[model samples]
Target chain A: MRQFFGWLSLVVLMVFLVIGALFIMRPFGEPPSVMDDYIIDNAQEEAASNNVVAAVLFDYRGFDTLGEATVLFAAVTGALLVLRASHKKEET
Target chain B: MSKIVRTVANQLILFVVIFGLYVIIQGHVTPGGGFQGGAIIASGAVLLIVASGSQEIKTWLRERRLSVVESSGALLFILLAFAGIGTVFFFNFLVGSRLFGGIPSVGPNPGDVWTGGVIPLMNLGVGLKVMAGLSAVVLALALFSGGEELEE
Candidate 1:
């Protein structure tokens, strides 16, 4: 049937895509870009932290972290608001 | 739901809390950070809730208290970020100072506790915020659902 061939072709295309992605994958423990080198070299001196990852997250990218916190707060606020509104309506 | 689960959870909660605190405190030097540690801590609370039921522990898991904790944590983090406004938004102000100012040797060594100026404090603040937020949300959802599966 046409539907059967359609699903079969879809599966074949996905398999090819997966194989291609695997072939092009970057090697483990080796960075693909230049930014990793710079962050590693300067993290301790710039942020005074031994953990380069933490240094980058907290100091170099503090704005991103701040925005993340804001988003979380907003989510919690929204959840409470929706839940409370329903609870009030039920009470009435 | 059972005696064994409640007993095990009661005993393990302390260790989970301690580990989470350790991760948060040593975040500047360790691989773990505020968000990871906070999730770990909140997981402990969730284990307790799952075993004991939220309704039973409703007194301790007060929504108002959790909201206050989350708000205070947010305030603390924002204040800490603003503290560095003298130079920049998130400057490492404690660097090179006598307090929390110890610098580490370059390249791959065991990190110290006293280093990482505002990072550790920020970790604590963010950790508190996340822990309170997640646990509060879970508790509220559980309470809303009446803490059980209902018949349709």
Candidate 2:
């Protein structure tokens, strides 16, 4: 039956997804030590903020932060507009 | 499944709210900051709305002047940031000598309430924004879920 084949395909796809996730998470080897030290030493001054995480998020990688804020703003705006439209439809 | 669980949950929500505020106040010296603390505090408001009726919550929100509080917080933040720029960009604006020597103009003492340059102000701005936005979301959801007839 068509339903049986559809269910079979879904199961196959789920299995492949699980396998892909496992492969990506598997650790291959140890990372370099120098990289860690470099990050720790230069984190504060380069970021120019007291909060280290804020520094990383807003200063060290400002472009990424801008993108993130834009995305969030867009999402919130979309949600608000959608809800407003629904309310208007209901009233009419 | 009984009255006891409901009481306990209510008590837990209160404790979480107080702890969240503690985190917000001690943010500069501790791991948590304004965002985490504000979110947690907002959760307390959410708990009240969920546990209590929406009409009661709406009455409380309007009576408390929360919107005005939020607006003032935002305005203060912008003014503080402007002060930094007015001094000079990246010139230790917050803690530098005065131009006319009328007052030392040295920034607040380190670790003082007024310290941290614009950080505290920014935190306040973030807090207000989060509080207001969450309030709006919760109110909207409450209205929608109550199934009240819409007024044009």
Candidate 3:
């Protein structure tokens, strides 16, 4: 039945996720640090800010922030557009 | 909402605005930043909107004005990024100069307010953008649900 297959799939996915988290994934807070180490060591001196996270967001990885802003702009534009259309019909 | 709620919301918004600005301005030395601070401010706006109906709120805040603020914030953010394009995109060009350029001693020490180069400016821009954008969205939703429309 459909219900049986759905349950089977759910169990299968859960088993795989648990195995991946327990065995395959590295321990938490110990990511590959080739780039992180450099950022941590030199961010204050180079970026002239005590907050390394801010330096990373505004200076080091700023292009990502730009993209994020663009995404927000687009989303807001779309929502406004959709909401405006319905109201226009009522006004006319 | 009741009379007491409206009066309390009116009085509390001032402190909310102050705390949000503090979070945004000190972003370079603290845990909070533009987006978080902006969200906090927008929450304050939401509180006001809830206390006052959409029809009452529309007399002061219109979609057109909020859109203008959002656009200005976006423009400022991009302008600050483009200012440093001579050396590289998003370069810390003002690192050693006088304006927000004092490099802090590299270790555990007291935080300095004027040491983030362009980051604080960028934070301000982003904070403005997010605050206006979110407030506009919530206002629009509230208006639509109440059978009202934002002014052109």
Candidate 4:
């Protein structure tokens, strides 16, 4: 079941990525994005950060960054738990 | 593995650590951000583990401390994110205020260190979390393999 789900997820990711590439991948050099323009123009004034990328990650798109952080935290917790559980099983 | 390798690692570790810190601390004003900086720092830790055997490292680098630091970093990042709840989930409230805040002129120029408000703080939390989490993984694998070898 686990292996099946893992493969299924990979397939899903590939499917989405392929679909996204076909429809959403912007052209090289000249892309269609007003959001990028806004971030670059007003990031320093609004977020007061010199690095526009940093401002975008931490301020403009913070929820996404938070989710990424949460994912890493959960991964570490799961790894430690599994390692400890295996050690306990050995002891018992 | 040998004396020469160990000596080289010992000398290079300090420089790696300092560079990582610079990346993390100046993330808001520099090219490198939290994740990049954290990975760099973790590389240094991995180098140390490789230079010295995991058994010897276990004496100085406690698993409990790594767990604590990792948890704290995650907590700090979340806490900082939540603190801007008044306006939004991650609002930059300290733009004009005096708490690690300094508004810079709009557009390209040399950036200020005491600016970027919560960004620098978030970078710090993320850097710590990544450093601890990665180091913990390497340490755990090393320790577990060491145990297996002993059992054999």
Best by lDDT: 3
Tell me the lDDT of candidate 2: 0.53
Model 2 TM-score, all chains together: 0.55
lDDT of 1 at B65: 90
Cα lDDT for residue B91, model 1? 78
Q: Please provide, for model 2 over A1-92, each residue's C-alpha lDDT reduced to its tens digit, 9 standing for 90 to 100.
A: 99999999999999999999998774767564565476456643342334555434433343453354345335544555566668678888
| Alpha-carbon lDDT of model 4 | 0.85
lDDT of 4 at B113: 88
- lDDT of each prediction vs. the true structure? 0.86, 0.53, 0.89, 0.85
Compared with the true structure, the alpha-carbon lDDT of candidate 3 equals 0.89
Off by over 4 Å in 4: A1-33, B147-152
Scoring only chain A, what TM-score does candidate 3 earn? 0.65
DockQ of 1: 0.48
- How would the candidate models be sorted by TM-score, starting from the highest? 3, 4, 1, 2
B54-94 per-residue lDDT for model 2 (tens digits): 67567657523554555555555445545555544222243
On lDDT, the stronger of 1 and 2 is 1
lDDT per residue, candidate 4, A1-92, as tens digits?
Answer: 99999999999999999998888777778877898888877888888888888999989999898888888888878888877777677778
lDDT tens readout by residue for model 3, B1-152: 77888899999999999999999999999899999999999999899988877888899999778989998999999999999999999987888688775789988889988998999999999999999999988888787654544342
Q: Worst 10-residue stretch by lDDT in candidate 4 chain B? A: B143-152
lDDT of 1 by residue, B4-62 (tens): 88899999999999999999999988789899999999999889888888777797678
Put down candidate 1 lDDT per residue, A1-92, tens digits, no spaces: 99999999999999999999999988888768888888888888888998877888888899999999999999988887777677678678
